[model samples]
Target chain A: MESMEADILIVGGGAAGFACALEAAERGATVLVLEKQPETGGSSAMSGGCLAFAGTEMQREQGIEDSAELLANDLKQLGGTDADPALIAAFATHQLETYDWLKAHGQVFSPALEASSGQSVPRVHTVDPADMVRLLAARCRTTGKVTLLVETAARRLQHDPAAHRVTGVLAEGRDGPIDIRARNGVVLASGGFSRNPDLVRQFAPDCEHAVFVGGAGNVGDGLRMAWALGADLRDMAQIKGTFGKHPTDELNNHSCLCVYKGAIAVNQDGRRFVDESLSYKLLGAACLRQPYGAAFQILDEPILRSGDNEVRILDFERRLEEGLFIQADTLEGLARQIEVPEEMLTKTVADYNAYVDSGEDREFGRKHLVHNHGALRRIETAPFYAYPSTAAVYGTYCGLRVDPAMHVIDVFGERIEGLLAAGEVVGGFHGNAYMTGSALGKALVFGRIAARTALGAAAG
Target chain B: MQVVVLLAGVVDPKWRLDRLGLRPGTELADESGLPRRLSPFDEAALETALKLRDADPAVRVTAVLPGDVGSDALLRGVAAFRPDRAFRFDTSGLAPWDPRAAVRLLGLAVGAACGCPDLVLMGREFGDCDDGVLPAALAEAQGWRFCGLAHAVAIADGRFVAHRIRGPREELLRLPPPALVSITNDRGNRLRHPLMKNVMLAKRGPVEVVTPQAGAIPRAVVARSLAVVPPPQRGAGACRILSGPVDAQVAELAAYLRARRQAAAP
Candidate 1:
């Protein structure tokens, strides 16, 4: 029953928690960060590290004309009709500052802007997100005011019912149970509930069948804590769905074989369902339209030999040997192995071959009409690969309801005193669908906001 | 051409003896305070060292363990890999400093023990701290070229060529003499387990135990050492097998793949 004390207790040492700790410590407050995992990066470290921001110093210097309004509108449109206007506005306004802060922290960014999911403009900025976390960690270590407790999981929040203030947290570390008392406030920067099947089923039932591609540590601890404290939840139906033929055996490894280049995906009924030319996110959603949200990517020998054969082909072959991929010599045989209907699979490939001969995908309107008549070689090629594609849930968009100031609110819309949330733990930021750089951007922006708001409340 | 691997034994808190339903007394505890297996990354390092040594008879492999006598079992486990030599240094009363201090001390000790070997290989990051800065720090302390997260390594022209995952892309870099490498378990590289013969040989081999030097004390001190507790076990959902018409499924998968690629693309 050891006890520790800090001015602010930030839970989850991912991008958001670290960002909040950095801001609070830099503002002259004693902060303590608790990470459930041994590493501080969380899923942020394993990500592609793309940061989306409009009108950044880099972008502005390059004469890329953009504004918060434009970005906000784009996000809202991209998220469809269900997006929250207030959250979008807040995220857009603060996104530039997030980018600027990262740049100031020595995060190297590529000057080249690329397109991301749901963005009309090429506003996606790429950087090593792990490096960014490392930089923040290094800074946090030097801050002197910030104490990091890794391999510590915050289980519950201690609240003063009379004052309606969250005074501390209950956590378990290597030693044992620890009571962390926070004088200022508590910030929950823990990530989404993708790994929690129950929560996923409750929130995103359509995507409950998706496989997880990220860390094993994302079990919705933050969301559960907030829910226990009567935090109002929103956008419970949203998810960041990943569409890839992820091998169940190599779930922990990042060994993804790009089947898009040379293979055609088929459903259980042996037919193409959606336009293969659409984005991967849309394709992931389309997979959910199937029976179990699963499909298989079929590839031939010629497609495997194409491109950087050593880099791409050998990597896939290695995975195949590791039993991460399912291979068969014939279309019927491949379907039988994965339990798909053999007769239907044969007919489906024949139809796809016919379409390939005509250089047209009438049903889905695929645009990459490179007449690879050779690619249409009957699925009779030896060692035909069939990677079962499943929905891998990266993160849930559902989280605690928050105001523009990033303060968590109760079900009745009353702000929870001394309790704040940021990152994927806060809802309405992403709406129905997620954009690529939005997670990192939202973490940085709302993390700073939560710290500032907590500081203000503490001062009062 | 002997490859000397500095195998530091770390406690694996995840591995439990299934038959006994308990852990052996000699097992090292992980941050969760549970009996765990050996560090997977360190095992990978040992595997790489052994592979390099086996590739050429001239290459000899040695293992080093820096801890108290309590770490003998762990050292024995590493020695089972049939290293040319194994040494256990006295780690008593040493203050746990930052990686910089640990690397400095270990580099000096290793230099003295092996007289500056051709190349030094270790895990990119230990599970305990996982800062991934130790090997680089050690290399910097010894004024040697260093590479982190090396997925593949090949020796050419008496220099080590390493393929590393740097950010998004993989880079092939060549380091000249006296290089230090921190190996990361990437997707392709797999570590092999020791055979029965190697294990028996390791059991019979002599493990040289060295006491601490006179007036030896670590320059750094651990402010506090905290145990890491394992989180509650999560319930895995039932596997839902997708079954239906093949054409419809392919159509559905294609759309999903395209959208995901579009989302992930730079």
Candidate 2:
């Protein structure tokens, strides 16, 4: 029954929420960010730290030609038809500016470029997501205008029907239930619903079997609140997963996808399945269809040597040390460790080796390591390794529908007046497929837009 | 009963070590950039504190973290566990081997927070080898009873009943109060998942930080430097390719592994 007030109230303190807080603070607005978790960073901290940007200096230095147009096209192609063209266009145009803003705000990006799941070029600019968030949170606190109330979870929005506005939000904190009035509007950047089992079973039942490795606090609180207000939804059926997660990995939630480093993925039958060059999401889809929904990334010593132990997708040796990898002197021995039929696995490796030698993959035609990059290598080393890989639902790609301006839109295509949203909670940004950096990118790009649009309207 | 809990987080063991580097002229490890988490042993000790608090409502627990601002995130994460009070005993300028100065600072911090705790709980190893010696030495310095390898500790008749696993047998030592016990990681003492509410509220809470004297202090030991090397590679060599039929290849690999194991046996 306590109360507080701010011009703009932000729900969730992940990348998107923090970005909004920083933006609103820059505009001289008194903003309050309510984070559900004790710590600020949500899934953003656990993310791969790659942001999708176009025409950056990093890209230029790497001699990789890229444009917003090409980037948007790739997003559209990957996201499928369900993706909102306007939102994709918005991400394309403003991504470079957001990148600059982040850098200008003490966020450091390593110049090294990496090619992730769906990136055409090495456009995935890397930043330590946790560090970036910590820096942002520190900056917000120092500003004095932005009050980040951690452990404060918003329960419901206060929508004034008479004024046709969202006045504030009611949240639970240390004291008890407290109401916070937002003079401008309320922005929901609370992220996705990947961690909610009931919600996952309802929306993405097919992928429910996959491990839930999302941020512990991401339970679709934003989606539920939006639904209560009649907000329309999009791409709900597009709840898929990323493929490198090890099912047995409890200590570390990372997956070493040696497959991208030219390892072949095999099913329980010990036969190669899909073309390993496809997007991990697509690979995950193929994996779910296999018997017992089991798959493994089988590799050899040469491929293992090529693994850059630092990178999750390439850390073959680390996984080997963790005993997550089964190394044997022969293919049959490797197969026995992973519990697959020895004979079938041996034949599969032999065929794959032949394919690599001839540079011709008759089954999957996977000539490249990942997405038209890197040459294929034969897995014929003395100690063959098999890393058990399972697809896990990381982030829910579908949720409340929103316009390019970051305003939550209802079923009738009308903006839920006074209700603005950002981050993974607002959908229609990603279509059917996900680009490597777009999830976090969308959160940043849209979070800023939401704040600017709300503040601009207030000034008007 | 008042309890002082000492907590220190280690760099996530699961993370690649390439991020660890020398801090140029400084003897300190460049830990500013890596992700840190509550070490298993730290969790065990914290769980011990919580269990003590839960068992007796009169028990008050305070957490003391010793580090620089680099540990703020970890400090906030620790706060979510709802410790009554948490203090960061700044160890920024102190040398690694200066247990004399370090213990003095810790004793001062503990006194400043809550005078003379009934129990002082900490992990057996304080992250690094040299620093791990502090807990045992601190117990002697404070003139408190010291116990080690207490996987679980419980209050029985106002005394500490510690479960220490010795070989295959379990020893139940009933130690008097005002003891310093170094907890080892045990499944029974895994820290429970803190509620999201407490997790949020802890960040806004104040962390009492105490700075040691700014003047350059003499140390019992001076570090020449530190070498951040990858752990020695295990079973390094070329893979021996066994060709021919599947059965022949399997038999050959099995025999090779057996022969290698026998040859290396002491």
Candidate 3:
């Protein structure tokens, strides 16, 4: 067995871990990062790299009039009543700083703000998550204060009982069991537990059997670690669902684009379920309401063409050619091919067309003012296309409860001294729904807070 | 001379822990629970096998996979590559098996069923475990010559010659009769993207099942467990893009590298 020591021991080298390591090391603390995979970049590396922030310097430069208060209010409203005001406030306040930090860290953001499904303002900034992770890893390597141990799995937390602090971690590496002692604090940036069916079943029952598209490394390690340390949990039932097909099979572009962009979602029975114009989190939950939590997004060629290349027709065409996308020229033909009810599908399409022509979505009250093809398209065009869609659950928006400073709390609402958390490990920031870019954004913000707090503790 | 190439399916090392431990689902969809494509290394092995089959019509390419019933789709996927015959070895219960145990079992089964192929082609290492020891173990078990990190291979004059990349050196070797060769990723032969027509045809191909002798192989030695901790996320300093002439950019890059190296030195 081998033993190592550091002033700050950050577990899980995904976006949060890397962010914390960089900040803590820059602040002059010796940082040790334990990564389970041969390479760094967990789920964050696999993401679309869309950072949704308001009042960013980039946004200001673009002359977009936005404020942190507005951003906070919008996030709270989008997330609904279950969202934590304090955490959301902290996130909004530090939103610009997070972007600045990323820019300072070698990440280049796109100038234009892309529209996400439910976001009110155009604030989605896209970058390559893999590139960001790579840049962070390279920078960490440059910092002499940081040491990265790859192919090492942190299994448990060793807490100081008298002091009620996380003192060290137990890990299994290629060499065997290794103990890593953090003189100050241990930050759990390991991602969510979507891959763990048992954990998903226990917490997010709605998406228990739903397929996942996020990082496989996110198996609820952070949540479990927090639980072991007696941290109180909240929003344990919240899970974010994505729209996709059986992940092992080829990806279907048409279905994903149509469903994500407000195309009518129908079951095999050929009936429209939920309002296509709802938020993605709600859409995912709605998709789960269908038969076996499986449905298809029905769209016409016009809508497909009008949608973004990445999210709409191009994705569908690619998937169709790859045998992942299922398509047909006629409504009846498609229904028969996918085993849906022809008459029901025809009626659904006809009714949808009626709604499109009138510019009034009576059933779902979908606003017709937006002109983007997928979400607000008129389904009057012929040669309709449909792709099988299902619930692809990512991380659960549930875990240990934390304060504004991101300190883990006990069941009695007492702060767990010397114990801090960030990223998906600490929930309640997101209630029933998550804000776009909030997961990665929160991971960056709280990870820094955790590091600074740990450094302060170490110095004391 | 007949040649047989063994195409083994390897999972992405990125999701190995989730696959073997917490996520008990056999489907790749179950691990990351996302749609997964074929492993690059396995695809390379398949490409090599197809090339060999094309070169020598008599040479039979057989894909031996140790998986369960859910692997039916995966087998169908491999068939898309146009192998002459596909064999699915039901070793699901023996999963998370150590490299040594898997190699020994595969050797015995190949010897009994396929009658010791003239040449066995395998990837240098599966992406998941990255043990990089399967070729040697299989070679030892079958009592055959072993060549590793093979980049190029060809059959000639009743023998097989292979080119291996050993660091900066390219070494060539010839093996007579029976031998095992491990293919490297950077090998000159590139894996071709499967055409849709081929994939459709593969879905309809017949896949034979070979059951290993009851308890004939030893259990795997290594035990894998999950690491509950997530990976670290360190941020990099912003990019300092230098504008001007190409020479100026190069100068800046050189200076940055030099400074980085100095900082890295203890």
Candidate 4:
């Protein structure tokens, strides 16, 4: 096999791989990023492009007070006891610095702050995810030390039995098979297995029938490669799907999260099924148990007007233009169009409005729009709207277990030498429930940490 | 029964082409960095062939793709379907923009790489270049019966019956062996997901690469240049958000909607 060498060899060129490469290259280390697809930007590019950060300029500019400590507390409270405290702490520690690093590297974020899923305050730093990946990839190229090889898929890790270290990777390139050696370390940033049906069925079997969306190249290559070496896995059973995906929507891949802005989700029976204030992932679980795994997001004119086109999940106008939402002058008409009982829907709306007026949700105990943010708004204005919704597995949030330093750990609680992982490939960040922007945030923060940890060890 | 399905993968529609141009001093459009996927039409054609094979154990389906090395992965994806035989022919210096020449070259590749196929299948548009002409032209050149925009195909009474939508109604046409049918995507012919085991096997297995028998064909059409341009915007008019009390706004909105509906009435 043909052979090549670099100071750092990274697999999968999504946000994590690119971030790792840029960090390593800037620190005077030569890096090689292997992207299996013809193009870069894996699932990170396919995401809604929201990044979770605390105490940023955007948050302050929007007059929203947020801090790393509050962010950490909210994550713990939302994720519950299952989340690894160390990883959560690491994210909270480096989130602000990573945000600044991204900005300094030409990443642009919209000035709007959104509170979704697990946030006490609005801190979702949104950007064009595909543009961010392209920007980072370009920065890596300008360093003159990182070689991004597209259409090159890493087949297996080359391990040294005596040293007990992962030396490099055996990959299949466009021309033929090649063996690449990493002098410092090998980082697995191959993202999640959202597109791999078998892996999805094996882990998140409950979400098997849910719609699948994400990068075409995300087939759990890194997870399988690390697992072959007996790496411990975490949060595999906690894989959850995002609610509000239209079952037949071919134009848009992202979900429409109207519930986060004060819309109620109702089942075919025209009755509220779950508290809309819960994270969309939890809502997705509840939705799947309903008849036909389907629900409708009921919103009013004011809620529809609250959509921000800059945010992917909140871009309700675009979804409306695509004819994904049913608009009716009256609630009865909406019920007729969606084939639900008019009386039950009317009663449901009346009850919800009463809860909104009384400042208490008697059923499901919902107070905020999402998590602990946004005041509840009564959906009384017309014309009303109903968005047909289903759950979609955006990314598998469970994978090989790793320390906060990003070193792959064995099932026996030993760190595998010279092996590191980041991004969706390494789990333990989100335990029981998913935060809206944390996946991309974890990719950026942990990716930089992995690079620093690897280079620091090499220097020592 | 033997069938040959022509698979011409298109550049993934999801990708925003930041830069696209013709290769210097050549008519070939440079698509070096763009991602490609099996288009709906290609999937429809392949699935129709697979459905036929599923109904009859005697049927042998072979998938043939004509492209350079970049399309090898696409061939492997096709191979995951476990066709009787799947292969890719060299299209190093050929451009499919010239429909007449493409038909001749494709005919040669099919005849040489895959044996004489009892029935030929392809999408309405061959690759991203052809605009629904190559299949019919190829069939005419080979002197075989032709059907276009077929949604599904089946065997009945030792002949192929093709179903297609034409204008307002669905049309069913029957033809004997040695025929060509161009397929259009439909719910009935949606491509089935490949098994993970077969996907892994195809990844490890060696892909059969065939060198097409080259012969000069006179070109009737040639692409001089190509450039990526933004699609024309169809103005639906700007959105007007209403302002006032909830009751007044609803009344005004109702009036506007009623007026618009009246204007739309025949």
**Candidate numbers sorted by lDDT from highest down:** 4, 2, 1, 3
For residues B1-266, could you state the per-residue lDDT of candidate 4 as single tens digits? 88999889988888887767887777777877776778888999999998899789799998988888888888888998889999997787678877778898889767854567888999988888887889999999998899999999999998999999989999999999889999999877877655333555788899888776565656777778787667676568656678743335768999989999999999
State the local distance difference test value for candidate 3.
Answer: 0.70
Off by over 4 Å in 3: A57-65, A245-255, A260-262, A309-323, A368-375, A456-460, B1-266
lDDT of 3 by residue, A180-232 (tens): 88887788888888778788877777775467766778788878877877789
DockQ, per model, reads 0.02, 0.01, 0.03, 0.02
Residue pairs in clash, model 4: none
Candidate 3 local lDDT, B1-266, one digit each (tens):
44555555544355544343433533122344432334666666666677777578888877766555656677787776666667787765565346677776677656644775887777777535548887788888778998887877788887878887677888889889788888876534566444333454667767777777777777646454444566566568865568753335768899999999999999
RMSD (Cα, Å) of candidate 1?
19.1
Candidate 2 per-residue lDDT, tens place, A118-159, comes to 777777787788888888877887889998787789999888
What's the TM for model 2?
Answer: 0.64
Q: For model 4, what is the C-alpha lDDT against the true structure?
A: 0.89
Index of the highest-TM-score prediction: 4
Query: Of models 2 and 4, which has the larger TM-score?
Result: 4
Q: What tens-digit string does per-residue lDDT give for candidate 2 at B121-216?
A: 999886664457778887888998888888988888988888899999999888797888999988778775553235446767776787756653
lDDT of 3 at B235: 68
The positional error of residue A44 in candidate 3, measured at the CA in angstroms, is: 1.0
Error of 1 at B66 (Å): 41
DockQ of candidate 3 compared with the true complex: 0.03
Poorest lDDT segment (10 consecutive residues) of candidate 3 chain B? B26-35
RMSD of 2: 22.0
Q: Lowest summed-lDDT stretch of 10 residues in model 1 chain A?
A: A369-378
